[model samples]
Target: MKGNRRSEMSVTEMFSYIQGFLSADQDVREDIRKVVQNLEQTAREILTLLQSVHQPSGFKEIPSKCAKARELFSTVRTQMAELKTKFPVEQYYRFHEHWRFVLQRLAFLAAFVVYLENETLVTREEVAQILGIEVVREKGFHLDVEDFLAGVLIMASELSRLAVNSVTAGDYSRPLRISNFINELDSGFRLLNLKNDPLRKRYDGLKYDVKKIEEVVYDVSIRGLAKEPESGGDK
Candidate 1:
């Protein structure tokens, strides 16, 4: 009888432990959701601001837009910093899913700002710096490589659309520059041994972006809107 009583006590204790664990998990997730919501809001603002690049006179406003986006990223960093504190450092992966999508959006926004300001691809390290996260996984709450690549792919697509708008805005030279940039970016992507399905899918979409920009460049070149490349080879 005593043995059966002990067994019942053990079973009850196990369930009690599990219930407590589940409760704690729920609380942490709720906190994380709140932080992630803030991050998403800031990301949306940045995206909206950057979308002006496709406007008729958007090129003229890039500098100001980039500056505003930078200010929004500062808010993202603060929210990310708060997110990092919601869960234990060692459990980064455990809670990362809650913020993964937002992180990718933030990465894309940072990349977009960098490109608008400097016409250069923002490095993964630079994205992390902009989002105020660590570059090293061991340091906790770091940006994942896949997320960065996804952002770059998204930026490439945006650039493709920008190439079309640049022509409408009477900036034929910009398409040629965009074509070269996308080509180089495509080549760099081909060199990676990507195993992530989502990232690989994004990489595949890059070819379409490449083709679209190429068509823009071709149309611009054939119409004599842009200077022709030298006869020998690409300059």
Candidate 2:
């Protein structure tokens, strides 16, 4: 009889605990909202800086711009770490949806810089590492794959502009290189089974970017300018 009574008391306590969990803490939500606001503002600033990446003379300015973006990202990571302590994985996603755009922009800015310098793709793992977040999705809050992919898509748009700008700046070979990079990126994207959402929409936008680059290349080629070697000169 004593054992039975103890079990009944445990059950009662478990129900109360569950009730508390069901309500959640409003204060935490508000705190996360405040953090999101700060992050959004910083993200906007970073986006502005990243715009320079596509300009004719903007490539040289990217390293410094990226530095500023990284500093803001550090602040974001601190807020995320705090939120992680108070919430579970799903809760993280709830708050993450609010500011994930900022993360994408920041990642895109950094990754684009790397691409400009090295003519290589910046892997998701590398972006997450630079952003000071975990790429793994074992249990708790982690970097979202969709967010990273969106950032990559954003880079595609920037590259499209860079392609046009390169020609305007008289660097035809850079657009050809960019065209190849974007083509490979597009092929890689095709392998992914995307849902009918923003990802797919962004993926569709890639075709336009490709067309713009191709037009640039074709115009150059048709004018008997295809065989010229790339001149190593700063724009």
Highest TM-score scorer: 1
lDDT string, candidate 2, 129-163, tens digits: 66666788775566688888898899998888988
- Looking at candidate 2, what is the lDDT of residue 205? 96
lDDT values for all models: 0.88, 0.75
Over 1-235, each residue of candidate 1 has an lDDT whose tens digit, in order, gives 9999999999999999999999999999999999999889989999999998788867788889999999988998899889988998888888878988888888888998998888889998999999999889997789988888899999999999988988887778888888989999999999999876888988999999999999999998889978744321111
Model 1 misplaced regions, further than 4 Å: 228-235
User: Model 1 compared with the native: what TM-score?
Assistant: 0.94
Which window of ten consecutive residues has the lowest lDDT sum in model 1? 226-235
Can you give the lDDT of residue 231 in candidate 1?
Answer: 27
